[model samples]
Target: MTTPVSLTIPTPAEAARWAPEQIVALAQANAAAARQLDALQLEFQAMKHQIEWFRRQLFGAKSEKRIVDASPHQMNLGELPVPESSPPPPAKDIAAHTRRARTTDYAAGDASALFFDEARVPVETIAVANPEIDGLTADQFEVIGEKVSHRLAQRPGSYVILKYVRPVIKRLDTQAISCPAAPEGVIRGSRADVSFVAGLITDKFCYHQPLYRQHQRLGDNGIKVSRPWLTQLTHGALSLLEPIFTAQLDSIRASRIKAMDETPIKAGRAGPGKMKGGYFWPVYGERDEICFAYHEGRSGKHIAQTLGTDPPPEGAVLLTDGYAAYERYAEKCGLTHAQCWAHSRRKFFDAQALEPERAGQALEMIGKLYAVEKHIREARLVGEARRAHRLAQAKPVLQQFFAWVDAQFESQGLLPSSPLTTAMAYVRERRAALEVYLSDPEVPIDTNHLERALRVVPMGRRNWLFCWTEVGAKYVGIAQSLIATCRLHDIDPYTYLVDVLQRIGQYPAANVAQLTPRLWKQHFAANPLRSDLFEISK
Candidate 1:
């Protein structure tokens, strides 16, 4: 029913006569796809390597236990018996003993001659009244003049004792109502005397009473407060201070320049055989206004949301470690990134632990760069002065470092197992950011300020395990931010927390920003609105 199809075969000449335009277009398309695949493959490899390296660095390796089962032949160094030495002769009575019998004749015959010579001034004892001495003199006035008197001399390890000083409680008798349902013959303390009993809890037990173990102490004190109640109270106090915490965040956001970094925390109880990790990212802004945000996630989104939608001012910069997340966010926001040289140098330093001879040279070169920065920082150089100093002193060191790094790249293939190689790659990738501080006045040479702020997260993690919930995590962020900021300004955290908690609610919404740590410290320490709270300790 169907006609046989005509079978045809082209000759070599006909096949070679294909269109030149079509051949060129097809080749170009193939090349483009090959390039895309190659790029994707490279990215995937780099990311996989980085993740593997990070895992080793953070969790560390489970070291193999070397079992040396075979026992070696023992050679004993026998103990030599000590020969007993003869005892010395006994001392004779000085009053009845002859002068020649004594070994030291001067002590036997020269008792009267032992008096002071002309050079030895035994003259007189000078008595001075210490201004710091506590006591009253005549007329209820402190003594001011020196006089000779017998007094107990202070011995070694002695110090003036300071008694317990309690904060003065204020009572407000706005109104009163008599209660008719009072228990028979029962008496009660004033309600005004009640206060939030707050104390810092560390890994240590209170006089050897741990938190779970503290039940006995509470019961013995005739108080029936449960452990959970104490935990809730601590959280409640933190929640009450949240407004002041928000005020600090607002202030940090208002500044032109900001620095940020993160530290890890462990949540041992989050799941079975799994440790949940959280981050403490601290951001420091203008006037050294510091704030820490504890993030449960370590993605680039944290950076994006923390640093809002704008570039820091023209000369302003954000200092950070070589975290790619930071780099991505910084580029997106148009902020100049000032990379930390300490982090760069630290990588090489750790390399010394694994590969001493090879890492030594790289470390020496990195060390020179740090020496220059240390000189500038130690001179109290900041802003334009610091920038100028670093430029003059550090530029050459950095240039030398870069040249050496280039040499290493050409000569060395960094093994994934080597930490030095990882560090070198970090420095090599972040070369531009590392050099930014030399040119910009507002940029810092290190992210230490932010790092120092976030260290508490890890230190606290060793004790508290994980945050109980998201709300608990938020509470920690607020409390830690306020407490750490207070420390930054050299203000006592307890005093600052108390003052703010009592007055933050009363502060006008328009001026709530003034309650920020930096502002609050200045206001409360200098010209305080509440005179009773700010009185200097006597």
Candidate 2:
């Protein structure tokens, strides 16, 4: 019922005698096929690069440092090429230099000497008797000097109750009774001492101990306390500290140069039997101070609100990664946006396994930029001098690097989806923002500082898992902000928290800035709380 279709095969002579238009069409078809093949090859390369990236993340070393090879053919981004051979150096005329043995010994020699400030640390002296002189009498031998060594000891944490004795007196005239008032506490009528509260907080946030574990520890130590009670005590302490936390935020906002980053946190109260995701946006200030702000979502509006304006105040330079939200915020707020070079470098770093030659070229150029930064940092250059140095050294490298990126993009005919093409586009789009550092000495080359600061949150999350409520996560952010800032300034978190907890109530609200870690160091540099005071009474 259906007619069969037949095709005729053309001979070589018949095909050659075809019209000019038909020949042109055949040539165009072949060209199109060639283009498609090229596109597919590019896509395959991109997929290969992606697979390598995942493998590196899952199995390879986490460090960004590339391995060094000693082979003559090895290439290095940080140094010059090695020579094939070198001449031997001239032999020294005299014997090789030798030094006389020194008599003075600079070794610690004893554990007690290991302490930089022995006066600050508690020391217990033990009397040692010589076994050779058994049953020695009072007139046995003269004592010349005693060798002193110390073994550090620690006592398990235990709860102590302070019985405040307020004497009550009765007046004979009117039979009126008067009693001495007790000092104000972090939480009124709560039996927990300020030091106890501080220890609980530091244990949870700084040491990454969960409150449940601490509760068990307390019970194991023969102190009966409920987990809920401990949680309440922590909340109460954080409530009192809310003002100081606010002040720190204000201080951070007032900074001219700030670095911003965000990390995830899980809040358990968001849904029934399921955890709700949240974010903690950590902002690092110009003075090395860091503050964490909690938000339900990582959006530009939340960031804007935290900074206290839709656009941050004028004259502020905000450093961030290549997040489009940040760019939009910067554009709206009129703030100087400085993108992170380390972020751009990471793209090429990830592509190295598949495109080593091209990636290495890009990395070497970026490495030169960092080398300039290293030189300036080593010289301790700042302000105009730092800017001048960057202009003199880094600006030229940047110009050449960008030009090379543009050339590669135009001439290579890479697919749009290729990783290398994506990397080039990333740099090409943010070229101006990346160059902001060359003009302003205040801007850092990367957001590595903020990224490093964010590590604490992730570590804390691993131990504690998640917060019970949004408010609890916020409290965590506040406490962690202070603790991390203390560590940044080399201040002991326990010492800072205890002192601040005891004094925060008495400190005037208008003068709350003094309670911040950086300002506190300036005010209390010479009179830090003694380490012995942090110890529990025996």
Candidate 3:
């Protein structure tokens, strides 16, 4: 459904209308629009495009990719067809179909009954007594094997409190009293164990559960715990992980090709009932690891801090959108800056309603580029072979795409400030940066990988909403970086966190990189240190 874009001024024109705020923004950007008739009309269409963009953000589908489907011709003038008295066509029989078998067993009332992984689960056996078996002799029952059935069962929360009862002994010689030093808590002399701390961090940051919610759940489960203690446990765990996070961040900085983006969060307090704004600059490395670095502002300085001050190697690539700060940083660092086709395509997609034919043509051209990329992946092209594939397949499409944009501009028919021209200019100007991926095999076509890695922040934002302190936000980044990297490597976040929380105290400081998810998978993940609870449960 299309939402109408409304303007405050009635009868602005019969051609287009825009939202009031969009008109104001356009007028501010182009001061002459409010004065000249031609500029006003152009701003009308431009603002219409802006209004559609806002509408798309609020109510439209999020995906920007497109498939080129043949649109039927919508007009036929001065055409007439003779009516023929033809016999009715014979009807064809339709085939009967059956429903696909599902995983849920309705009769037994068990969900996921068909997809159970038997090897991973330990079986608990229960014996049932039948009246016939009561009367039968033991020899008769002993002669036959038993039949069994399986059902997946679950308990809420699945948390167990270990009531440790350590023996207390007094030394008779010196009247010295002693008990096993209470198994070390993450906090000095605190009762909370490393296992509890690991679970709290995983549930809060990785699962996106806020501490107050966990506190409420703990209360519901008859376990009395304060919300502040959970917060403190999280801080304590992250404090131990700060060095490892720094080490991983260094590894990400050393990668040849990287993608980076910023996201805002409400961190710290501005005033009463207010929040100060901050950003997390997340960088994705070639080694398949990501680091989320927190900074108070979105600027080039933060980019320099995360990447480096010195210039990158001769062929290093950095993928990003047309964000000005990234472009500036890339230029300053002498990196081969590549732009995202998805970002360019998104602009034309948003302006589809304003100029359907132009937008459709641009979209069809961009679709060809993506199709070449799809074939490259399907063929499993790698290294120099991948670069050669892009050169042979994608390079021609890229050339055609840019030449089409240049033709549209040279024709001099489109409004100077209209969305279509703006989109064409955008692609035409970035031709150099957008063509970088054609020659470099390791560089990705877009920053979607980095965007995906940083999504935990936004997904968790919906649940937790905001952070009370900047320090809390930093801790959030620290935990999320490792957790996100763990996911990239297909490692379990809960298992990794539990083992590291126990092992970090004794792990060598110089070998801290071994604990980062990328290195840990290769070295330490085979037989990681386990908490006392894990050992006892086993």
Q: Per lDDT, what order, best first?
A: 2, 3, 1
Candidate 2's C-alpha runs over 4 A off are: 1-43, 72-184, 310-314, 528-538
- lDDT, candidate 1, equals 0.58
- Measured against the true structure, the TM-scores of the candidates, in listed sequence, are 0.60, 0.75, 0.76
Superposed Cα deviation of residue 373, candidate 1 (Å): 2.5
TM-score for candidate 2: 0.75
In order, what lDDT does every prediction score? Answer: 0.58, 0.77, 0.76
Task: Tell me how far the alpha carbon of residue 292 in candidate 3 is from the true structure, in angstroms, after superposition.
Answer: 0.6
Q: Candidate 2: worst 10 consecutive residues by lDDT?
A: 149-158
Q: What's the CA error at residue 396 for candidate 3, in Å?
A: 0.8
Error of 3 at 173 (Å): 9.9
